[model samples]
Target: MKFKLLAAAVSSIALASPVFADLVLPWMSYRTGPYAVAGIPLADGYADYLTMLNERDGGIGGVPVRLLECETGYNTEKGVECYESTKAEGSLVYHPLSTGITYQLIPKVTADGIALHSMGYGRTSAANGKIFSNIFNYPANYWTAASAGVNYLLNENSGSLEGKHIALLYHNSAYGKEPIRTLEGLSEKHGFELTLIPVDHPGQEQKSQWLQIRRERPDYVIMWGFGVMNQVAIQEAANIRFPMENFIGNWWAGAEHDVIPAGDVANGYKSLVMNDTGSEFSIYDDIQKYVVASGKAAGAGDNLGTVMYNRSLYMAFLTHMAILKAQELAGTSDISQAEMIKGMEALEITDAMMAEYGLANIGPAFSVSCENHGGPGLGAVSQWDASAGKWNLVSDYLVADMDLINPLIQADSLAFAQENNITERCN
Candidate 1:
C-alpha cells in the first residue's frame, strides 16, 4: 500500500481520501551514478530493516511502514524532486543522505513542517536545531568528524600537535568542504600546519593531489571523499607509497570497496567511525530470519554486514525509535508531521535502549534536545586490516573538540538564521 488515505481517520497523517493503514517513510536513495557502489548498500540496508520490522514485528506499533524509494542519482536537483513527489504521500520524515540536498531542503522542510535527518552528512551547522527547526544531524557531523580526527592525532602525539603538518584532502563540494573550517581552527589551536587539497567532481583525476601529498610529505593526510573519489584516492595513495598508517579517511572514504582495489597496500589505513560496523549485533540474526530468509531482503541480500549497511541500519533504528516516541506523545498509532518533529527533538538513544533493539554499542549514547540536536559529538577510529578484509575500531569512543566546533556551528547557524529571517526557537 502507498499510504493511508484516512479521509475520516482520527490521525492527522491522512493526506488522501483512501483507506490506508501505514505510515509513509521516504528514502531519497541514489542507486546510480558515481556513488552507486556506495549508495546501493545503504539503500538495501535501510529497506531490509524496515522489511524486518514488518515481517517480524508486524510493523511498528501495528501500523505498517510504507517505504517510498526515489532515486536521486546523488544529484541535488533530483533530490529535491524526490522530496516534492513524496511529501504528499504522508511522508512526515525524510532521509536525504546528501548534504547538497540537505542544504536545499532545510528551508523547504521547515516550511512544510517536515523532519529531515541528514545523519553523518549534511550542513554541519544544522546541528543547531533551534534555528533550523526541522533539520537534524545527530550522532555526528562533519565538524565533529574533523575534530575527532584531530583529537586522535593529538592522542598519538602525546596530546599535542605542535610543529606537525596535517593535510585535508577533500572533494570540492558542499559535503567535502564541511570540515575545512573545523580543521583549520584545530590547526591554529594545536599549533600545526594545515594544508587544503581539493578534488573536483566525480573525483576521477587526482594525480596532482597525490603528487602534492608526495612532495609536501605532510605528517598526516585526512581524506573527505565519496564514491569513486575514495577508490581513486586510495589507489593513488598506494601508488605514491604513502605510509598507510599515517593516512586517514573520514567515514565516507573508508569502506570495503574503497580499499579492495589497492589490495594489501591499503592495510593500516584508518578512518573515523560514528557507529560500529559489522553485523555482530543480535539484530542481524533477527534480520536474517525475518527479512532475508523470507526472500524479501533488499538488493541481493549480500550487503547485510558491510560498513555502509550497518550505518543504514543504525539510521533506520533511530527513525523506528522516534516513531514509537511519536506514537507515545500523540497518544495514537498514527502520528502527524508535527508530532514526528517533537519525537525527533526529544528522542534519546542510550546503550541500554540500543541493547533492547539488539544493537548494543551501535554507537555512542546520544540525546537530542531543543538547544542541541546534534547529540554529543562522539566518534571512534577504525583501521583497515586488509589481510582480514575488515575494518576494526582501534580506539574507544572519543568526543570531538567542541570548543572549536561549537563556535563554528553557532556562527554559521546564526548567519543562516539572519539571512533567512528565522526566529530562534527553543527558548
Candidate 2:
C-alpha cells in the first residue's frame, strides 16, 4: 500500500507541473500610441486590478497571476506581432481593445483554442456566439448600442422619424463600421434617411464632413469617433451652430479628453457609457489605496476615471473573472487556454458580484454560454455636465430590447458570413 501511494503522488505532481506553465496572462496594451492618453488609463486600471487580485485576494485560485505587457500602439501589424510572440507562453486569454486588431485575429485565436474578450467594441456580428465561439463580449455589441440610440431618439422625438435625416460621421475603420449595419436597419424601420460620412483614421481634420453636416442639416448626428476626432467633432459642431444635444456619440466619443477640449460648449452632449463612471466606487478607492499609493500607477494621475480608463478597467475585470471561473470548473489551480475558454463561455455576472466590485448599479450582470456570448445588453445614457467635470448617467439601466436586436444580429451575421465565406456552426 505504501509503494502504490508513492507512485500516485508522483503522477499527480507531474500533472500539476505542466498546468502551471500554461496559466500566465500576456497583455497586449498600448502604453505609447497616438491614443495612448486614452489607452494608458485603461491599461493602468486593468493592471491595477491584477495587482489588487494578487496582493489583496491571494492571487486568483491560489495561483499568482502575472501580466506580460507589450505595447501595440493601436496598430494592427504590431498587434499581430504581439500575438505571435506571446502565443507560446500559453496566454490564458487576450483582450485586444482595438477593433481593427480584434477583427484580424478572431479566426486565429478561435483555432488556437484561446479566448478574446472585446466587451464594448469589435465586430458587432461576433456577438452571436454560435459563429464566433471563442470570442466573448459582456455587454451588448455595437448593434445593441445603435438600436438603443435609435430607440432613444424615437422616444424623445415623440415616436415619429418620418422624413427625418440622420447623419453618421465615423472614423473610417472596422470599429466605426460596426454600428452602421445596425443603424441602417433602424433607419428602414423608422422611416429615417441615413447618411454615411467616413472620416479617415487618427480622426482629425474633418473640415469637409462638418461642412456637409452644415449643408445637409440632418435632424440627428451620430459620431463614431475616438481620440482627437471626438474633440474636433464637438468643436466643429459648435462652430457650425449644430444643436449639441441633437448629436450623440457611441461610447468612445464621450470622454474627459474629448469634452475638456471643447469645455462648456460640449454640455448636454450624450454618450453611450460602457460601464459605471466616477471615483466614488469601491474599486476606485481600492485602486487609490493600493495601486496609486504603491507608486505603481501608470499614466497621468488625473487620468484615472476618464472614459478610456474606465473602459480598460472594465475589460480587465471581465478577463480576470473569466480566468477564475475557468479554474473553478477545472477544479484545479493549473489551467489551460482551453479551460479558460470554457470558463469564459460558462461565466455569469450576478448583482451581488457587481456590488462587491463597487459597481452596484452598473446594470445587467452578464451571463455567458455557448450559444449567447454577449452576456447581456445593459448600459445607461450619460450626458456631459461641464461644471461638475464629468458625464453623469441620466437614465437608469435602460433595459435594451434584445428581443428586437437579436434578429438583426442574425441577419448581419449572415451577411458577414457570405462576405467572409464563413458559415455558422449551428446551421
Candidate 3:
C-alpha cells in the first residue's frame, strides 16, 4: 500500500542522506487568506503532530522529522514559490491544502520526481496511479464524495432517487466545480434532476443563489464549499428556513466554525467526512500531553479536537505512517527522496494500523496499489447536532459508485496521459 509523496534522491542505500539529517516534509499551508479562518486550525494540527512525533516519539522511525512550513496564503503562485524554495531541502513529499495549488503542482512534482499527496482535494482523476505516477490522492477524493452524497440520498429515500431534485450549491472555483461532473453522472444513472448553483470567491454574497434555491426547493442541497463560504451558506440556508436536515455539506464545510456562527439553526445540517470527528480518541490525549501541554502547540491551541484540526491531524498521522513504511522499504533510517516515494507507494493503512498508532477507528481503512492511487473512496455522513455543539456519524463508512467512477477516472487520466505524453505504469 504505497501512498503518494516520494522524492527520488539518494538512489541507493550508499547514497542515502547523511546520518541524523532531518527528514523534511514541506507544508504549503495557508494561515492567511480568504480561507484563513478555516486554514488556521488545519495548519496547527499538521504542525503540532510532527512536533508531537519529535516530542512524544522522538521522531518517526528514530529519524528526526522536520516540517518546513511555508505560508501559501491560499494563493497558487505562492504555493509554487514555496515548493521551489523548499524542494532543495531534501524534502521527499509535499501536502498542499489548496486545490488550486495542487493543480499547479501536479506537473511540477512529476518533473521533479517527487511525491504529491493532494489529500482529498485536487484533481480527482489522479487516483489513476498508472497515469499520475508521482501524484497521489489516496483514501478519498472529490468525485467519490459526490457519489457518496447521492448514495446517502438514495439510502434516505429507501433505495430510489428517480425524479428527485438535487441541487449542488458550490463555490465557484476549481475546487468547487470538482464534484459537478460526478454528480451529473450520478444524476443520469439514478434518474435524478440535477441543478448547479455557483457562488463566487470568498463567497460573501450568495443571496441570489439561496433565493433561487428557495424558489425551486430542491429535495436535497449538497454543498461544495469552504472558508467563510461555509458559515455564510449555513446562515443563508437558515434564514430561508430551508430544512437543515435536507442540506448536506462536503467534509470541508463540516467544522464547528461552519455551524457555530449559524447557531441552533444549523442543527441537523449534514456533511460527509473521511476521518473520525470526535475528540474521544486516545491520540488527542497524546497530542494534548506531547504537543499542547508541552507549550509547543501551533496557533492558540484552542482548535484541539475541532473538526478542521482533526482533519489535519489525520493527514499528519498518515504522512507519519507513510514515512515509516518508506523507511522499512529503503532499509535505512536516513532514506532518500526516491526511497520516500517508494515507501509511499507501498504503504497500507488498516484498522489495526490506526490502533497501533494510538488512534483506533480514526479513519477508513485502505490499501494503496499501483493502479489505484486513491484508496477505497469510502466516507461516512455526519450531522451537526447544534445542541451538543458536535458532529455525529449517522451512517457507516459508505462506498462510492466506483463502478461509475472508474470509467471516469480512466477516460480522464488516460486522456491526461495522452495529452501530456505520459506512459501508464503498473499495467
lDDT of 2 by residue, 110-195 (tens): 78888888878887667788778788777767777777777777777898888999999998977888788778878887899999
**Mind sharing the TM-score for model 2?**
0.90
List runs of model 2 lying over 4 Å from the truth.
Answer: 1-22, 399-404, 412-427
Task: List residue ranges in candidate 1 displaced over 4 A.
Answer: 1-20
- Residue 124: error of model 3 in Å? 0.6
Over the stretch 1-427, how does candidate 3's per-residue lDDT look in tens digits? 1332233332554467556789899988888868887788988989998998999878988888899999999889999999999998998789988898988999998898889998889999999999998888889999999998888899999999998999999999889999998999999999999999999988989999999999999999999999888999999999999999999999998989899998999999999998888788888888889878888988878898888888888988888888898889878888888887787788899899899877898888888887888988987899999999999999888899999999999999999999999997887
lDDT of 3 at 266: 96
* Alpha carbon lDDT of each predicted model: 0.90, 0.80, 0.89
User: Please, what is the TM-score per model?
Assistant: 0.95, 0.90, 0.95
The TM-score, computed over Cα atoms with residue i paired to residue i, of candidate 3 is: 0.95
- Model 3 misplacement above 4 A: 1-18
Judge candidate 3 at residue 255 and give its lDDT: 87
lDDT of model 3, residue 324: 90
Worst 10 residues of 1 by lDDT: 1-10
Q: For model 2, what is the C-alpha lDDT against the true structure?
A: 0.80
